[model samples]
Target: MPKSVLLLWLEGHLQSWGYDSKFGVRETLPFPTKSGVIGLICCALGEKDPQDDFLKELASSTMEVKAYKNKFNDKTEQGLSLIMRDFQTIGTNYDESDPFKNLMIPKKSDGTKPVGSGAVLTYRYAIQNGKFAVFLEYEKDLAQAVYKALQKPRWDLYLGRKSYIPTEFIAQGIFNSKEEASQKLRQLAEIKKLTEDFSVVEGKNCDDCDVLLLNDVPVSFGRRKSYANRYVSIIKKED
Candidate 1:
């Protein structure tokens, strides 16, 4: 049987996928890692750590990805260019002053968990003007259910990092084809009466632009670390 795919477009000023993050400072993995996406699924299901059996089952499924290039336009010349960069993390130097340092370190359950050997995999796609698409493949029934839930989401959508909550619904919907998905997204833009800031288009790569990928590196809290990733990019929307 053919796999069912749910195509979602996340358009926003900033997006981050935090795989392994700790306290005050968070860290973002290069691409949307399996753990990160699984965390999302858990969140959607209103679950937390000490995961249940269902969570394990969900994590055992297959996932794939394809990233695209982001582009920007030169106002003076009305020319478009690709804006891309390799992201890096800068750590803040600080001395460990914790009295419970010995007891706070990871135990077997925390440190032994594998990062990549799971059911979820994500691709990072950067689009021109902050527009990008995500294609999720899963069991047909599950895919359809997820697609339907996303259309009128019960919970607010935020970049993997919770700090950057989207002002609008980032995902448009699941569609039969890319073209159909694009058209539906356009229709949504029209309904919202949005302008170029919310424009959706087709293209894989960007040219002649400086797109920087920011990776959030985790920092320590007091005893336990925060799960949120802190990597973010602030883009000024052109009017």
Candidate 2:
């Protein structure tokens, strides 16, 4: 049997997928991560804990991502998008009386107040206006649920974070094969005048891949999120 491919359009003024981050500098992988993709699916289904069997099915399924440049620029250019860092800071701007202000303070695992404020300046990287085509292999029933949720999500749908909203619709359609679905999606997008700038697929289809270890697989994701380690390949391209 052939696999099912779901076409998604990811485009926004600012979007960030922080695969590995500690404190000061938060960076994004050139493409999306399995954790992020699974998270999106869980959120769509309104699944509180992402480590459930639903997520397990998604994580185990194959994901092939193709990142594209902004459509405004030359389509054939393939100039390669840029990952710009967004400088941000917290705590100082919050009002003392507002309960929301307390969020600026770091809390312990037990939710106890900290000794000092967690206010600090930091940089977050994002692939601005980047488009991506995600091909997935999942059971038919589950795919239908996901497609419905995406059309009218139980929660807000985001690229990698709540702040990054896709400019266009993310759920295009579901088809029997990746090629057929993608081809039809392109046609529809052209009629609607959407972006179709193709990007390199490092691990599955592209070349000169640099495989790296990523620990983004979800072990549990409700109040406490846990993850297991997995190997992923990074694709590099010329500007």
Candidate 3:
């Protein structure tokens, strides 16, 4: 049977998937880690700490990603081409005396363990060329359900942090073929509702070339020494 897949274009001014970050000088993991992606799924499902079975199911699923290069002109320079830097994350200062800090602290299951000691930290980043893409494989029924849910997303989608809202809808419907996926994305672009600028292209490893092209918008979070997040959306050019 042909596997069902959901092609998501996750772009924001700043996107951070810090699986194991330290208190000061937080670091972003390469690619979305199991814990981070699953956490987001749990939020979308409107549940926290979901059942073990649910977590296992999601963790066991196959997820793949690829980075791309993005080139654009810097507004500061007169038509000077600028290479946008990949998104990254910075750690926030925490008060050790605060009780809540301990609970929210990045720790391992043994509880009281530091991240670098044994904890796993994973983050996802794509090249800046507005060409990065992620491919997710799921059970057919589940994929369809997810696609439907995206049509009318109920939750507020953000880059990595909630404060950084998406310029366009991140979640899109499932498609039968790569052609179909590209068509849907084109339709979205033609409508002129995207939050940032972007383009769509074929997937490199995709057999059918089923994938969405995304151009991320640069955004910063917090004050002083803020990190950048890239926001992206599905779009197409008008004929």
lDDT of 3: 0.45
Superposed model 3: Cα runs more than 4 Å off: 1-3, 71-132, 177-239
Number of backbone clashes in candidate 2: 0
Write the residue-wise lDDT of candidate 3 on 1-239 in tens digits: 56576766555555555533544434443333334444555556554432555555554554544332332332111111122333334223555579886455566557764654333433433212122245566778877766555555556555455754445455666777656765765565345333222233223433433343222211211132122222222233222
**Taking the candidates one at a time, how many backbone clashes does each contain?**
14, 0, 26
Q: Which portions of model 1 show Cα errors greater than 4 Å? A: 45-51, 72-132, 167-172, 175-239
Residue 119 of model 2 has an lDDT of 60
lDDT of 2 at 20: 81
Q: After superposition, how far is residue 201 of candidate 2 from its true place, in Å?
A: 5.6
Report the Cα lDDT for candidate 2.
Answer: 0.70
Q: Candidates' lDDT values, in order?
A: 0.43, 0.70, 0.45
Better of 2 and 3 by lDDT: 2
Worst 10 residues of 1 by lDDT: 196-205
State the lDDT of candidate 1 residue by residue for 56-146, as single tens digits.
Answer: 4554443332232333342222212233332433222222366465334333455552343222223332212233344556666776766
By summed lDDT, the worst window of 10 consecutive residues in model 3 runs over: 74-83
